[model samples]
Target: MTTPARQPAEQQPAGPPRPAGRLVLAGAPLGRATDASTGLAQALATAPVIAAEDTRRLHRLAADLGVDVPGRVLSFFEGNEQARVPQLISALQDGQDVLVVTDAGMPSVSDPGYRLVAAAIEAGLVVTALPGPSAVTTAIAVSGLPVDRFCFEGFLPRKPGSRRRLLAELAGERRTMVFFESPHRIAESLADLAQALGPDRPAALCRELTKTYEQVVRGSLAELRDWAAGEVRGEITLVVAGQPAGSAQVEAAELAELVSVREQAGQGRKEAIAEVAATAGVAKRLVFDAVVAAKRGG
Candidate 1:
């Protein structure tokens, strides 16, 4: 007797689409206008209502797509997202599809659309997304560090102590990490990353991705910190190699080597420590310990 063949998983039906009068969180181009998806353009051109982080940018994007935005557009941003959600939800309840777009990237990832998305879900409104490029992922891809698993810490606190405290919390993270920082503070933040994580840890400074003058500089965190110190400009994304397992025990020896090499290369103690920790993919504390031990002949 012949046995019946099992059905392939690909044959499984994906359930029906959610109702139409829902909220669509769309992604805008981080840079390179062509990165916008077809679905995003369609939604922007025809959604019954468009909730944009920047209405002027929305209009500019519509012009780029050569499509007039006929929908009613409302400004929704960090300051106004919570307050504006109720009004937007009321539109969804009335069977209008609302599209939420940020100036760049997906609306809710380090952006202002999370509140509205949460509100819509609670209101039993269908929610969807229009996928697009993300700086977090893009920077990680080009960072030359392990990306099998990673975490995005977004922007760290502005204050030095607070920022250092946050980095301390992440000292044990084994997965690669991504962060965003302002151009003005990139130097200080990188120095902090070097100090907290380690000077020799591998990292990349991604600037103006996908735009003209797009640059990805891969070096030890300390080197990038020094480079940033001179004169840095543009939106910045930092991708750091994660802490290596068992790095603590061998840190002293590694850091000794770092100090020796950098000293020979003409870098001073502070600069050597920062570069060594960042390049070694270890913590700055480890480098500091090694430096102290070297001084004491331990």
Candidate 2:
């Protein structure tokens, strides 16, 4: 025999096996289709199981993006999200990647998919996200208010009384507040906000963001309320300025006088006290004590 056969070419070792499955929460565009991310396109094209808030909307989005969704599509909306969680989790356990998307914006911010994400995490499944557009952040970014700190207050209660109570509770919140409202209730909600947070509170009304009729109106709550009273349309997001800094340090005498003035202006004792405390950014109890002490001295 001539020479030994040349040694076979060395081969690289295989990498570690990936987990069986993963849950990916992809954010859709708030309004415009072009805002969708490339990761969304890739996930739409490759994910084995796609759970969408609306399968029809998902298909429409895919068409707009010129991407073909070759995977199985399933409905994952509020109406059926609870029931579909188990099935989606099972797919993840089988090592299949599942993509969760909503009709607009992120899947869990004022949308469905939170339950599925929690369940997936509980089941030891890998959960990730593809960042894209979000109505909350978009509204806040364009609000022209202090964005250093903010809070998202999804949608207010549908019932007026419940909504008013909730607003009253948050009247003293020191962080910029963002709220989502329906076209029909935007006016009423703004009016309630004006009453709860005071008419002079600065706010912005962002409507139909990233869409054809996009508009952002910056003004006091009273001004926004008046504007909302007219023929307002499209998805609405309200951004409210937080209480002024140092307001919580008002002197006890001044706080008492403010409470007295509110009482004289027709507010009930408790209501006046609460309103004063909120406006002053002080504890309600402090206001209450000041009011009590003032009454005793009188």
Candidate 3:
């Protein structure tokens, strides 16, 4: 997705935005409360209105951090997120800073807060974040899989048919994937992923990350599925390796020919190589190497 070129400041309408209260998105730790950032602590201690996914968790976290939440605590979870966004926005519009926190990790990431954030933005309010530990990045770093280029799919579909359809669509994805899964559904999801992505596809199961019982299990999709069968538990983050490079599906000769054809049509080698890679859904390096090998062979 190419971002459109920004208009010149002079040419911009600017929406004539107003300055009221800002929305602070605070990221909570996946496990240990200590992982919370200082900014997060300060935000929790001082925000005038807090929209928490779970008020109980917020209180527990504050207790652990030895801070007091002087602000009015409001429940802002999935079930009530829609109903509560308006109220939170109202508070912000009244020049009262509103802090949004989820039970774990960043808000709006498979959690509550997106609606409120979007509302705040549409209302021309300032929005900022207190970043902290995220299971998606942590699991990818330790997954032993390629992480330079990856995508987070969040939680996999719960329904078998939906899950299967999604898996089928992702079968050829070349970017590493990260997903959140429940302990009960881990076994079934893994099995389905393996069946769709292939049994030998590399993957990792990260359970209770950063906690005392933290475990990182790296193996093939089939192996992870088997391990998940034997009493798996905890907040899970699964990292699966992407399908092998698309070059594997195309002969070097064919890849070289594709690039050459594009080059013949008034395209520079770099542009031709990029075009071939994009069309073939492969990496540029692979296509370049194939072109080089074909030159040597000739």
Candidate 4:
């Protein structure tokens, strides 16, 4: 981005020096430029410093809004956020309001801005935000799932083993889950989600949210996996149904079968029952009773 020369103090009319300026974490438009909040234009015209993830996009947004950014623009992406927070905090300490904006959505969300926000807070500086379009809430609103209670899991790990492990950890989570995925890995992620959560678990795959070519695919995880087999593109957001209440437990007979396999693998009967209880989400006493009944040929 083109950096403008700093305005000299004497260039402006004399006025009382301002107090410590606030750190504003503003949400940039996710897609259409018009989606920017009303305060955005005012902030652009007045903020003394603007830290943008992509200065080009920031400039484009300013042009679309028909406003001038009288602030000093700095590249504040993930690559340089750590190195740039000190500069931003220094500006805040000098009574210059610093505005933070990402390429899209809110800053500090799966994007850069957390480090700076944290630094500002630790330094006892005022920090605020401008609420606007967010892909996370946007996806949930259209997910067709219970939105009253939900959790955002951010982006799943790239490694297959790590991804599966994370999914397994969430298998019994009762609240709806939201995730962001890359187009290239959506297919594999959906497939893994189906296996770890359940093929019949309801889910929605939201793509290019709030943009032209926006599409939402809602179905069971298994169905989504099949659909993702074809060429898919654009940014992706996934919302998955939570496990049903008391639905994770297995039947005593199935629990007995699992315990039997564990015993055959050289585990003691008591230890096998305990292991099955934890793994199958069943009570240990239930497996013990099933095993005893099987021994009596009942």
What lDDT does candidate 3 reach at residue 34?
Answer: 86
Across residues 1-298, which tens digit of lDDT does each residue of candidate 1 receive? 9999987777677886545488988989988778889988888778989999999998998889888898999999999988998999989988899999999998889899888888888988899988888989889988889989999999889998788868876876789999999999998899888887879999999999998989999999889988888888888889999889888546567678778888888889888887876666555776787888777875
TM-score of 2: 0.81
Error of 3 at 45 (Å): 1.1
Q: What are the Cα lDDT values of the candidates?
A: 0.86, 0.88, 0.88, 0.88
Considering summed lDDT, which 10 consecutive residues are worst modelled in model 1? Answer: 277-286
TM-scores of all candidate predictions against the true structure: 0.77, 0.81, 0.78, 0.82
Q: Which stretch of 10 consecutive residues in model 4 shows the poorest summed lDDT?
A: 277-286
Give the Cα-based TM-score of candidate 3 against the true structure.
0.78
Q: State the lDDT of candidate 4 residue by residue for 117-202, as single tens digits.
A: 89999999999999888999999999999999999999999999789868866776779999999999999999989987789999
Better of 1 and 2 by lDDT: 2
Winner on lDDT (1 vs 3) = 3
Candidate 2 residue 13 Cα shift, in angstroms, is: 22
Better of 1 and 4 by TM-score: 4
| Model 2 stretches astray by more than 4 angstroms | 1-18, 251-298
Q: What is the lDDT of residue 101 in candidate 2?
A: 93
For residues 1-298, could you state the per-residue lDDT of candidate 3 as single tens digits? 9999988778655675445898998989988988989999888899999998889999999999999999999999999999998888888888899998999889998999899889999999999999888899999999999989999999999999788768866766789999999999999999989887779999999999999999999999999999888898789999999888753455557879998998888899999988876565455777788899889888
